[model samples]
Target: MRSLCLLFVTAAALSGCASVRTHQGYLTDPQLVASVQPGVDNRASVERALGRPTFMGQFDNNDWYYVGRELAQVAFGNPKPKEGTMLHVRFDPAGNVATAENLGLTRVVSIHPVGDKTPTLGRNRNFFEDLFGNIGQVGSVGQGGGTADNPTGGSGSN
Candidate 1:
């Protein structure tokens, strides 16, 4: 009984270390992808064979993309992509498939945003300044109107 209890605890601990694998975007089929021959298959034919693309080009309608990503997530952690594929299919002016290219995870680049603070012109004010700086500055003129300091109805200065 003692050994069985230890085994149960060990199994439980091991299970915590396991990560969940996930597949996102289009499910790739190698045979079907191979059957899509460039210069022969048009947009309609390709759609019939492989279904609609994951996304179309933003500016140009002739370019199609089929993106796939495999991610792994540990308990209480964010999911991270371990592998990914981007299939770029470009169509010619005649509407037939012109080229098909496969891009791998090696092309992936991650960009982290600077911070929550947005950069703007003028001086940076503190929390107290933001809360109380404009207390006595406002006048009866209202926004875009003139103040007592400047009767010309401008922003008090040139």
Candidate 2:
């Protein structure tokens, strides 16, 4: 009985540490991708060799991208990228492959957003000040036509 319990505990611990791999986008096969020759292959030929691309360029239609990502997650933690590939294919005006670039995960750039606080123009105010600053002042609920003397209406004189 003790041995069985020990085995169960060990299995549970190991299970929690096991990583799950998640794949996103197209996976480029090295050998197949290598078959594409710049200046020789066109859009249709490249598609036949490497399958459909993951996405196309935003502003232009000549650039094609085949992006692939592999992420691993353990337990309930967020998945982290382990490997990735971005294959960029640019076609010339003649529709022939002009350039081919295979970028790896090392080329990725990560931008972290600013913290919770947002900076505004005026001086900083506390919670009470924010809630009660306009308590005594009066104005139309959502309108901005209020004046100093007539807080809820347009300027008194036309």
Clashing pairs for model 1 are: none
- The Cα local distance difference test for each model comes to 0.86, 0.86
**TM values, all candidates:** 0.74, 0.73
Give lDDT tens digits, candidate 1, residues 71-105. Answer: 99998799999989888889998999999888888
Candidate 2 lDDT trough over 10 residues, lowest sum? 140-149
What's model 1's lDDT at 76? 70
| Per-residue lDDT of model 2, residues 47-130, tens digit only | 889988888999998999999999999989989989999999999998999999989997788777899877788658899977
| Cα shift from native, residue 110, model 1 (Å) | 2.1
Model number with the top TM-score: 1
